[model samples]
Target chain A: MNVLLDNLSLFREGFIGTLELTGASALVAMVLGVIIAGFRVSPVPPLRIFGALWVTLLRNTPLTLLFLVAFFVVPKVLFPDLDSFLLAVCACGFYTSAFVAEAVRSGINTVPLGQAEAARSIGMTFTQTMSLVVLPQATRTVVPPLSSIFIALTKNTAIAGAFNNVDLFNVSKTLSNDGYDIAVIFLWITLAYLIVTYAINGLFRLLEHRLEVAR
Target chain B: MAEVSVTKDAAPAADELVALKNVNKHFGALHVLQDIDLTIAAGEVVVVIGPSGSGKSTLCRAINRLETVESGTITIDGKPLPQEGKELARLRADVGMVFQSFNLFAHKTVLENVMLGQVKVRKVEKAAAAQKARALLDRVGVGTQADKYPAQLSGGQQQRVAIARALAMDPKVMLFDEPTSALDPEMINEVLEVMQQLARDGMTMIVVTHEMGFARSAANRVVFMADGRIVEQATPDEFFNNPRSDRAKDFLSKILHH
Candidate 1:
């Protein structure tokens, strides 16, 4: 506990770093996930195939492997001199997007087929039916699964600590080397993650509550 | 009228609103609609009736191309059903469909459900759409339930709202696919009365239903289908009292007794 007080700035930087990483990646994941999910349900076969292929590659790979690839491979193969932090963000964000895409696709499926048909019968085009009728209804079932995926994403950001990102996991290592109790360091890290996860849950619960139509 | 090719786009008579010719469709091994031919003049009320799996409902759905056929043409207002895109949507705006399950937009208020198609498809101003929606809801007798979600309403109320939603488009023809079949017995007539009133007002309607009393009273022509074919087509009195086909006789005997 005394060690924690002594190293307050380290904990603060780590806490802020974790939040920044999560926020940036969550944004990336949501945008990519929605686009991928759109591809998954698209009437075009090529788009559907592309969506499936992306999810398979990202979702099946280990998070550690993706971090390594983002750090080592992307800068060499894709962009020269890209910051390592941005690389790790892309890794965590795109990886979680696969899970997010699945959640969104399943949510779209939960909407009864008749809802789309009904929209069509009344003269709505495919896009109109989806945006106006299907997606709004699908969103009700989507929020819960999306919350789980995002919470998992927050915890998954810890993987960045290993790749020189200076996130919470890295802070634990730095403090432990300076003779802080490992258990106490781990305990605080766990508490920080719990706060983030609970905040994610609260946000999604509020969205879900607001989305529910009367009755 | 000559045997009009689907490609001709030649306006059939000014009165002909819908025409399905040589339509054939199969669901895997079963041919659900076989070489079907039917037409409805403007303001004519056609009632389609048959036992389960007899293809009456399939026939009703094909007009709007909700259930597309394998090799045939369905013309609405003398034009072929557009394969896809905005043209098809425009064609559908003139054709209102009511489903057995009501299929109201469950997340929307009854008023929103009615306003949606008008605003999105018809491109009506929101204020105009809302006003028309209120009138339609009032017409269907669910005016008070305008702000309520579909889940909050009873089955009958939901069904009426569905009717109002379709009617909001000012469709040239209304297709009712077992509108009363999913309702409670006590609530069936409320919906049927709405249909009866629509028929009396000379709205072109094609209803697929088991309610024979409605057929006897409202249908100008009763089409009896069986095994994916039109077994009998005649005036209501002639079809109900003197069913020509043995299939129609058997179907009537089984259903009309109780």
Candidate 2:
């Protein structure tokens, strides 16, 4: 208990770092995911192929391998002075985007072709139809899957702690190793992750309810 | 009987509202519309009836370029439908279509569904468009359901909303593709009533339906198609009383006897 109280500041700092990393990486991942998903569904053959290739390659490879490449290999080969934190965030974000893209693509496909045809018949251009008619419907259908992806992303951020980044997991590890109450430290870490994931999932549920009501 | 005058102000001549010359269409080695030639006069109600897969629906769709013709020319109100772009949009704006499934935007209220094309395509002001949309809904006897979403309505009510949506466009010509086919037998009359009212008001319409009663009562001419070709054309009374083609007689027997 005494050790935990002493290391309270360390826990706070680690939590803040974890929050920042997750926030930035999740944003990056979501944007990339939507773009890739759009490309995957595009009528243009080349763009569709490229999008398919991206998701296939990233999803098939292990995230740890991607992280190593982003941090150790790519930077040394290209820009030697790239920041470690940025590299970690990029690697995690890009790795997660592949899964997110597949989820969004499936969501888009679930929207019936009639919706698009109706839009066209009424003189809306393809973009207007997609943005107004299709995407909103697709987004509603994809909410649960998207929430799951977000939760996975949050947990995966802890992997960055392996690279000397003082994320929540690393902070707990160091404190517990340094004669802190090992069980308490680990319990706190678990609770923190649970709280974060639970809040995200709760938010998704609220959004889903709102969509249902709107419908 | 309502005394409805067909609009004469800037209206084209009798042969001009819609004309198809030597139109041919196919579905990959299966010819759909073969050497079809037809004309729709202003304020005329033409009903197309045919055996299944007879290209009746395809022909109706072709008028708005929903289904392309392989060879031939289609002109709307003396303006030939261009092969691409803005001309097609302009042409389509003058035409309206209602489907068998009552393809109302499921997410939108009846009023919004009616107002969408007016605001988006015609670029009408919201306040005026809403007023027009309301009037259209009232015309279709669905004004009270304007605030309701499509999913909340019965099949009959939904089809009425679709009619209102098309009417809000102020289209010169309307196409109905088996509009009452998806309705319950009891619900069919409600939709047919609305269509009968439209015909009484002298809307130039091309209807593809199996409802012989509507064709007989409201249509000026009935076109019968068979095996992807128009086998016969006649007045509804003549077609029903004395069908020239054996195929038409057989189709009428099957449809009417059951």
Candidate 3:
């Protein structure tokens, strides 16, 4: 379409913005997910309660409400001059982290109890046992589910388009406002998302292969 | 559950490596261990034999404090079992445990499984750890399987690697909790042979097992337990040939006949 070539730079910025948003939020989600996963299994009661609350609250809350809180209320109440892009990142990243934590927890549970008992019997400290044995095995099982979560995250970035972030979805909105065919704009957005989603899937498959250990 | 001497006649003296006095444990409504008293002398091989759910495994597990006691004391080398944290871990390193399931760090290669505890807990150099691990694997006759993951090996080989892994730590005491129970009938003797060698070498060990032949041939003392109590403790000849309690006789006849 002539409209697409005329607005090539807008489309380029939109692609890059979607990548930036996904990358930044993915980093946030992964780091927070691991920490919250640790909390979910900690021996301390207060930490366990807090971890339970974190997953339940964020997972139960609708994404649109989170965006409203992140976009509309956060700047008014939390940070007056926060960029809407960062706010969108926060909303998406924080929301996805709850799912990430649950996936990590389930992965950990898949490791047999005897593994930890054996590690303990050998006199390995809890940290050594986790780092050496439990996490290594848990990591293998986690790859598939974590990849699914990340792919969901990549698609979920489209929601940020509504919050004034100029990502792939926003590019379609702008093109439509300028009288471009809606079908063509939507197809382009879908293709961009597929690229990102498939990229995540491929990366996780490689990771799964690397982490594979014979049962 | 009354307090009386369990293994008083056969009790060994000097250098008591492990001692449990009046240890009790419960699993919900079931009293698994009741007022237990057991001690292991240096180089003593005590084979614990009992029916299923007789608490032999629980008694062995309680040694390294894997199964916590409801009340009473367990001391290794005169120091009380560390309640938790680093001290307990350190003590566990000194007491090697071989389980029925082999528990051989499934993700690691056989060599790595043998070497990890040494390098991580004992802080041995990697080369030295590897050398020691290799030697122990050879000793247990699974040296060729070193590079393989646990699942790749047969049950017998996996159990042998497990023995080597435990032995690599140079433990003050080795606890065998039904180490060969999960093995095939042909594979069982291979694992038992390694344990026999350990007994011949005078490794301090407390073995919980169903293998009466092993108990008769290799045990310094055979402890007969039933109903969460140590019903008899005697030399293998005395206990196997002439079981004192009706319960042990019933158990021995059923086991020996079948």
Candidate 4:
């Protein structure tokens, strides 16, 4: 109890850091995923190849390797003065994006071919067909899979600790190093993660309920 | 209304509203359509009938280029169907297609499904499109279900909504690809009744169907196809009463009794 009381500020900062990483990474991954999924399904052969390669390459790489590569190369080449926090977000987002793309593509496939054909027959362009008919329907079907992606993303953000980004994992590690009750600190952080993940699951459950299509 | 002529050759007459010349299509090793040469005049109703896999649906789809032909020409109102880009879209706006699946946008309300093409394709004002869609819905006897999604309606009601959606575009010609095939026996009559009314109003239509009753009562001419070829095409009386080809006679024998 005294250990937690002594490090309340550290725990607060760590929780905030975790939230920022998870939230920002999730947003970036979702946008990138949609674009990648679009490329995978596009009529253009080159874009489909690019999408295929991107998912294959990124999804196969471990998150830790991505963070090391991003930290080592991205800062020097892309943003010399970039904060380690933002770099971690980028690494996490890029890695998770491949999963997001696959999930969204599966969602798109769930829509019947007749739906798109009907839109096209009525003079809707490919873009119009996707936005107005296919994607709207796909969105509903994608919720559960997308929620799983984000849930995995939340847990994976702990990899930022390797780069010394003071997230939940690092905070608990610091407490252990300082001769605090390691088991208690681990339990508290584990509970914290459970709270966060369950909250995310609940939010998605609400969304799925609201968007459920009537049969 | 003007008197209409049907062309039998590659070059259509000046009066032909929809024309196909030697249209051939293949899906992998399967030749879905072969040497399809047909012509329909403005406001003519032609019913195409055949056994399953005889390319009836493919022929109807090729008119709007929903199914592209491997080698042939399809012209609507003297203009060749554009292969792609904005021209194809504009051409599609002139030809409305209804599918066997009722293919109504499941996420949209019945009225919105009808209004979408009018507003998007024809650039009709939203208010005017809505009003027109309401009238079409009423005509199809599903005006009360206008606010409901497609899944909320019966198969017959959904098919009627699909018809309304096509008519809302004010197309020069309407193509029906087995529109009643997906409906239950009792439900089929409701959709056929709506189609019969459209024919009476002199809407140009090319229907692919097995409903002998519709062919007898509504179609100006009946075209019988077998194995990717049109075996016979004649006025309903001639086609039904005295089919020239043995294939047509055999097809009629099976479907008419069933």
The prediction achieving the highest DockQ against the true structure is 1
Clashes of 1: 0
Compute fnat per model: 0.79, 0.25, 0.88, 0.72
Please write out the lDDT profile of model 1 over residues A1-215, one tens digit for every residue: 77668888988889888898899998999889978988898766898999999999999999999998888888889898888679888999999899989988898999999999899999998789888988877887888999999899889989898888888898999999888899999998899889889999999998988886433
| Residue B30 displacement in candidate 2 (angstroms) | 4.9
Segments in model 1 whose C-alpha atoms lie over 4 Å from true places: A176-181, A205-214, B1-14
Off by over 4 Å in 4: A78-81, A177-179, A213-215, B1-12, B83-86
Tens-digit lDDT track of model 3 for B92-136: 999999999999898899999999999999999999999999999
* Candidates ranked by DockQ: 1, 3, 4, 2
On lDDT, who's better, 1 or 2? Answer: 1
CA lDDT, every model vs. true structure: 0.88, 0.84, 0.88, 0.89
Model 4 residue A114 distance off true place after TM-score fit, in angstroms: 1.7
TM-scores for all candidates?
A: 0.91, 0.83, 0.91, 0.91
Clashing pairs in 1: none
The window of 10 residues in a row where model 3 chain B has the poorest summed lDDT is B2-11
Clashing residue pairs found in predicted model 4 = none
TM-score ranking from best to worst? 4, 3, 1, 2
Model 4: share of true interface contacts reproduced: 0.72
lDDT of 2 by residue, A93-155 (tens): 998899889998888899887676666666665556667777878988888898999899889
Error of 1 at A6 (Å): 2.9
Candidate number with greatest lDDT: 4
Q: TM-score of B chain for each model?
A: 0.94, 0.93, 0.96, 0.94
Across A1-215, the per-residue lDDT of candidate 3 in tens digits comes to: 66678888998889998999999889889888877887887655788899999999999999889998997788888799988888888998999999999998898899998898899999987677777888778987788999988888888888898789999988999999999999988887788788888988899888777666334
